[model samples]
Target chain A: MTDQALGKPEADRPAKGPLIYRQAVLTRITHWVWAIALFFMLLSGLQIWNAHPALYVGQQSGFEFDNAILRIGAENTPEGPRGFTTVFGQKFDTTGVLGMSELRGTTNFVGFPGWATIPSFRDLATGRVVHFFFAWILVGALGIWAISSLLNGHLWRDVILKPRDFRELPRDIWDHARLKFHHGRSYSPLQKFAYFGVFFVLFPLIILTGLAMSPTMDAGWPWLIDLFGGRQTARTIHFLVMVLLVLFFVIHIAMVLLAGPINELRSMITGYYRTSPGTDASLPLEGRERGRGRSGGRREIPTPDSSPQGGGEQAGANRQEKSK
Target chain B: MSGLILNRRRLIGLGAASAGSLVLAGCDQFDFLGQRNDPVRDFLERANSLTYAAQRALVGQQALAREFSESEIRQGQRPNGSTDPRQNVAEYRTLEANGFAGYKLRITGLVETPKEYSLAELQNMPSRTQITRHDCVEGWSCIAKWTGVPLGRLLDEAKVKPGAKFIVYHCYDVMGGGLSKPEPYYESSDLIDAYHPQTIAAYGLNGGALPVENGAPIRIRIERALGYKQPKYVHTIEVADGFSQYGLGQGGYWEDHGYDWYGGI
Candidate 1:
């Protein structure tokens, strides 16, 4: 929603009405690089966590203290050492997946199973190595992406939500809830919000919290530790961010499959997205899907000049000429 | 801007899918990543240097780690690594048997005077007691009080040689020797950290004599580093220009075993 959108420089964007070059080559490359880097970082991070397998809050944590908010470990049971995961003092038997797990028939005590970690064995040194390396790569990729996205106008026109997007938020939510995804020239209001949240909030939070956990960073920038409460709290927040990221990952994949897997994959892989027939490349996201049996129930997204009044079907036949 | 996170998410999703298929997917096949002569391993290891250089450049050597007040010492320092070197080394056993009265810390290598100080001599020297957090590399933090003479003070008395680049802390605990003889655990600190004010050769914990399991007679505490870098049961402090003569030439026992020598993180 800036001068870039007003200019509409993409003259040949609408190829046969549906196919369009949506994602840029740089975005595609960065996306795949990030994917690979994250694959290594998350697993190696799990391997690193296997070293301690416990998380706490506040400034201090040790044998004499019981302030841990989350702990994935095993304890001596009547039969043998059984695995359990505790969250906020509530324990759950997470045998086989967490804590006690079998590695070639010999069950070992680990935070995450071998299949979930880098090296697939206990090696904190190697884990840290892989984790840190990929971490730098991720940071570098993010830096490059930030610059390229800004230069390409994707940050402002595609990702950033405007006042109109906020007004249309309910429709986007309803569309997502009912699997009524609209393949548009630009992202839906929900897509913009989600992407913006990931780009600005989660990524930065995770990275900062990660750095705050480092003793060197703590020494250099004490305010970072203070920002996150403490090193332990920073660590806990880091873990939570990882969890949220994973949730986002699963949901994103599910959405891709539900909306149109082949089209979405092509868009990501080849930077060419096949937009819906109703999607007009000339117009921005304002009223692209004007009246194509859309807006099943209540229409919350008002057109550029007027409120959209419609129904489940045959409600916008009279407004077709008015929209044109 | 969303590409990396999406990229990561897709990669993780694919990894999870492969994991469901029971194929050694994602990170499982990354065994080649850490092997010697492997390009992947070499590349990964290089990142360690990058991290080290970046951290040093950013934090510098003079920045002080956060020091907690007396009230912040909520618990005793967690005993880790080779808690009691006496269990393995007979020399340490003898020192422990005699209340460490016969123990002597030998400071050798590239220094003006290769001096030896008894436990009492080290205790009587100018000391600093500060409450600090010990951040274990395994991702845990424990705060406790530690009292010992500043390592800079000891290095000053010995008059560090010009070419000395590192201070090696040789401990009594034997962590690994592979197929060779029993090699005692050791760690090294660069001169920048070596001369830091908070780097102490500690002998007291929680206002009491340091427990045997807590490195007993002496432990080297680099305040801004991880717990593993703080070598316990330290009996020798060697000033050296390089690590070519030490275990596998990496600088310390853990470093020899693939741990990064720089433990600031």
Candidate 2:
């Protein structure tokens, strides 16, 4: 090959990395399809969750109202300590109700009064409509993706970690911490762990929880409620899982920003990954150091300016220091 | 010309592909974030009438949700929401004590007949039994076999006036001694649902006395609606022109709160 073709660098021109193809068109499409489907599911799920909004540590039922006072006409006025009630010649404690009532007073539902809100309120009927319609769409897309990925060997090459992948995990973790790696290659173990968890655990949990909410389905599939520890619990878990999925999406977007934007963007968009020569398959060994690997800091950030051998210097230094 | 056209084609192809992917990516965002009614929302609002018309057109007014065998009945079916109804419990208990011999359900409002009948008289007229689920808005459910005369029969007997368009059930539960904004438990449904074959004025559960907590004497079971619309301890069934100008002017008591007026869930 000509010198210019092998690794081009000219005056006023940036050095070029090796051409690498990682994801196939199908993989890219399916990955993005899953992402979009998840977005709809999360937002609609949030609106439904807002109806029975959850509360944090000290909040009371996630609602607010004033403490109700009872005037018993002097014969049974609340006496003794704070938040105590007296009823018909006997005194009783009402500390719990008082605190809950006070909390309820301040943090009520947003917008107009409760009376005018019923017809206009966002009803479950609407939520259920969106939920079921999109649910079928998601299922159809997922089915097509699963079949396509299996027919291709993309599942094997991309998802299943190879023996070498396992062996290099610790080094990869160190490399990732120092931001020394590049894209257009396999994902690290931590990423695989999260991806697998989302696919196997979280997605399935949401699907099952959605099924458990149906009354007609419940008649035929009562066991779904038992499996999810009852209907309300399933609803709560569905909401919690949705929050986790949204958090995952936020973190994923942040990572895309931190990594070299153009390089990362090209890989996701075009199914072709352009990597620096050091991280490229042509010079793979140059990217990893021997004994100093775990201690030698490395990261997965892509090289800027399209340099082919960008990370070689730091990698070489780590190798020599470990060998000595 | 060929080379230039080929370059342009490739550019267009790539742009089309990118735009397609971007559209697909943003599709779900548009779906979730936007507040728009779906086909099912339309379907739910119209399902009662459609189901009614379909039954009339096809099954000749005899269609119903399938009934199950005796052994299929569940055990310990919870009372669901508003279980221990707070209004007129003493009145209900007094009837329950006497096995409801003195109990009568009065049918009035926008009806030509406006007749009140004893529980035995209502039970004797063309009964139907179906086991269906009570889906609560609070996210609990229970299956119970209900046997009663279709509300249509009672309404027909009462001869609902022409202008009458809805049936409002006055139930026996006042919430938090009127603290709950939607106090005085009650529910209502359109004429389409009020006449559905499955809709019944149920007086028995699991083939025994209607327990006090479970709306003794009678209750309206609008099966497709949520549990709160079931309207336990149904004292009177009134056909009205519209829910506005009724109690609190928002249909049923629960509907006055955040619950949907047509809770066909």
Candidate 3:
């Protein structure tokens, strides 16, 4: 709302949109909780991975088995002991990182350096303890979020991709590829797809594979081993899922920065968002030709359960309905 | 415009790298949470029992670990954690040298009848052969054939007392036991794992005698737990009401060193 923050000319100031509350209180709270919990889970997870620096694709793996798909270790060469990482039989020098790195004052050979782990030391016991505790926190938070989202119809309205959403997919993808973004009240097709994939696909896959690696779970759910092929294979999938989640996280943050960081941050933090100005609140149909209607301010994001007229959230919904 | 775009891309890449390194370095400052005596860790670690209880509910007591066929026994089990125990090497060698004729596994503590069995007696008793996966806490697994008497048979013969809640396995290995002290390596199991059909006192692996590298002569296997929970080079099994008298009173060697006592996960 400040002209200085916009850094635009007097002509552009006329297009500055009103700030409407687009995120709910629950959304803001859960978002921060997940941020903290994920930070702990990711680091502690790496700590556990450091214990066994190799990944195999079958039920059993050891000196006698040759099915390792990834292995990180240090080997002695004519030059000296050098750190190397092998993936699918091809090896790469990963010195000063991955296989070997300096910790504190001394360089030592380790799957991942001390700093990457929870304890900042090579202690599997501590790493597992840390990993499991935070794991519970994540599972619990996700459970609460899912139930709350379902009850409030947030799952259906925002996250679930409707048939119309598919029609916008190509356009959304093209806009994203070119660094263009649409500032709207509801989530765009891309955001819906990303959030849906994260919540419904990636998160469940990771948790399921993690449980499959447990001997007790395997005993109780005998079919779990068959589902993933084997315990070792489950572990491999668990590792792969972690990598994908990291990829998602990196892209997510990059998009936030590329899009409008302050506006985005304020929405998630205070439930307020600035829709790009076009249609006036009093004259919504004036900008209908632009296919983007604007409105005054609303205090909360629209839940499909709540349908009040004239509110910004309702205005966005009505505009979307007409477009469809 | 092209040059500016390239510069922006390079800037983003550098930003990501520095942010990553900063996070890695920050973990060192947060190591206090990992400190053994820290209250924060102790509070967080209380979740271990919750997980144990949850998994116990999910996996009932009688559920059996998946058994593999003889053909699935692909390799010799990986030897880990006290492959060569620090203590009782001479005594262990004497037992091995004489074909283990002199070896006697002692069953004592809260049992109604304390008993000692020679290697021959254990072999002669009822036996179970299982080709099961050996899962390590470090996250690798190996499959091999294990032939030995079920541990429950020996516990029944000894007659565990009503109050006895766990069985502590004292091994010949001294893990991190100081040079002057030489504390033996040990692990304990509750009755649920104790009576599981696949929980056996393995004396043979891959259809051959158990190799010294893999707890030769005898090692008890609790099939539903990780490798560390299965202590190797065992010489005694003590029935106990609680872990108060064991190494640091935490149930197992690794448990005392900050591992969760429940190994089901």
Candidate 4:
């Protein structure tokens, strides 16, 4: 089908090229689902963190031992209620946001601001409910995504770093540092690395460490605590991983906007992506042709109107065929 | 790089605009989205119940919380929440002065024999010593050696009634002293937790007589649960069908104020 027939916007229409189907239908759906799940999880996780704004090492830690690596607390000073965050003995005044914040005109002492929490109140019950609800969704989505990605060889063909990726790494980093994003069918080495690191390493580690911290999970899998050194250590690791994930999210969004948010968002939303006109030669033609071949039953263009019924299974099949 | 900077500025501008609009729309709207009776909360409740059930299924009722070695024990168990008993209560003051000699642990409600035991009687019972970690919901942990009579033995001796589903620990410590009213600190556990082998009415901590700060002359130790569940200054054990009669009807003091009743973690 012609680019004009697809009814893409003028900005999305390249001067001399067609729109490539970048993200599969499954990818788009799961991406949005994950986005929602992670949003709730992050907020609720922050709420849970407020209950005890400290992270420690080893099997056990308490007031007796000075083993707390991180602590967010508010103290009643002569001046006023002062909020402080201590990280490895270095204390910082984080009164307005971290340890204490003004919520609806009330100066409330909480680890994170009310705006950053799920319930936006000092309610551990509500926080836990929200957290566990999204946690299950996140875990289920991740499990399904992982299994399907493996079955389709997307894990190997797309995200996994190839030997060629190593050679392209420095150039990709240099280009990204300069904000010179190349429009192509395949992800940049940097993008691949970040996505791979988050999906494979960070996500799994966070989940495992989270389980390690669960008392019930300890009964079922005692080795989890031992593997992570201790429950407290697992909690520390979980907190660190959460921080890293937040960092990744910030950078990811920045990159998306830098490259062109509308185009990037549209690709993940509708599976159609517009690349620079003359960059078709640089596109991964073999993968594209393979996708087209496997997606033979449907030829409907993924315009805004027709995207929802675009058939995720067919798109998944096409991606799988491409991987093969 | 200039193009990048311009784009970044535009992104920031867009974000600021959206955020400003959201704030202008009123923060209460956000709260309304997460209102107590919202369908989201119902969904979350279902999820929590599912987790509770699944965890129960995965880990058998008898599975014990991990125990530690003596070397692993920290400097001492840290006293949390309300450490001291209410001084205004003359009985507590008199008991404290006499080293808890007058302290009597009463076992009532849903038992064949309503019994009361003094500190000496409790200490004379067959005891078990365990070096276990006390994980607080506040994210810190401590290891201490707890020596006490197994709660199962006590329950057997008292002969728990068939309908009894929970054991409520009535404590002497009263939080937030005021002329109007003071709240007694209390905790409860299901029968499974109550009868667990590690559940004990501890009279000794770290190989010494339990300190006043650590709930002398006794505290209940349910090793599988959080520190709050192992309430300090325990004065009475009431066997009940449920804990609805307790503070706020949520089973415990902390539980009343939004903490989970099933504090397995």
Indicate which candidate wins on lDDT: 1
Local lDDT at A74 for model 1: 90
* Candidate structures ordered by lDDT, highest first: 1, 3, 4, 2
| Candidate 2 segments exceeding 4 Å error | A1-17, A54-125, A161-167, A276-324, B1-118, B121-134, B138-201, B204-217, B220-265
Clashing pairs in 4: none
DockQ of each: 0.43, 0.09, 0.43, 0.34
Q: Chain B of model 3: TM-score?
A: 0.87
- lDDT (10s digit) by residue, model 4, range A1-324: 322343433325334233456666666677767877887788878878898888888998767768888999999889989899999999999999999899889999989998888678776667777777778888888887877666544565568787888999999999988989887656889999999999989999999997887776786778889999999999999989999999998898898879887678667755666555444422253343433433421432333333342233223333444455
**Candidate 2 vs candidate 4: which has greater DockQ?**
4
lDDT of each: 0.80, 0.57, 0.79, 0.77
lDDT tens per residue, model 2, A169-246: 788788778877655355666566566667667778887877666443443455765787555556656766776887
**TM-score quality measure for candidate 2:** 0.52
In Å, residue A114's CA in model 1 sits off its true spot by 1.4
Say which prediction, candidate 1 or candidate 2, comes out ahead on lDDT: 1
Clashing pairs in 1: A35-B7, A35-B8
Worst 10 residues of 3 chain A by lDDT: A282-291
Give candidate 4's error at residue A292 in angstroms.
12
Write candidate 2's Cα lDDT for B1-265 as tens digits: 2353345446546755775575455333333223434453444334334333432343322333334456545453456456665343576567766877988899999999888889889878888888765666644455568888899999998899999888999876656454544466777888867997788999878877566677777888876556777888888898999888766766887656434566543
lDDT for each residue of candidate 1 in B77-136, tens digit (9 for 90 to 100):
888777767667898899899999899998899999988999999999889998888999
Worst lDDT 10-window in candidate 4 chain A: A296-305
Top candidate when judged by TM-score against the true structure: 3
DockQ-based CAPRI category assigned to the predicted complex of candidate 3 = acceptable
List, residue by residue over A55-169, the lDDT tens digit for candidate 1.
8888767578688988999989998889999998899999999988987678888999987888888889989988999999999999999897776667777777789889999
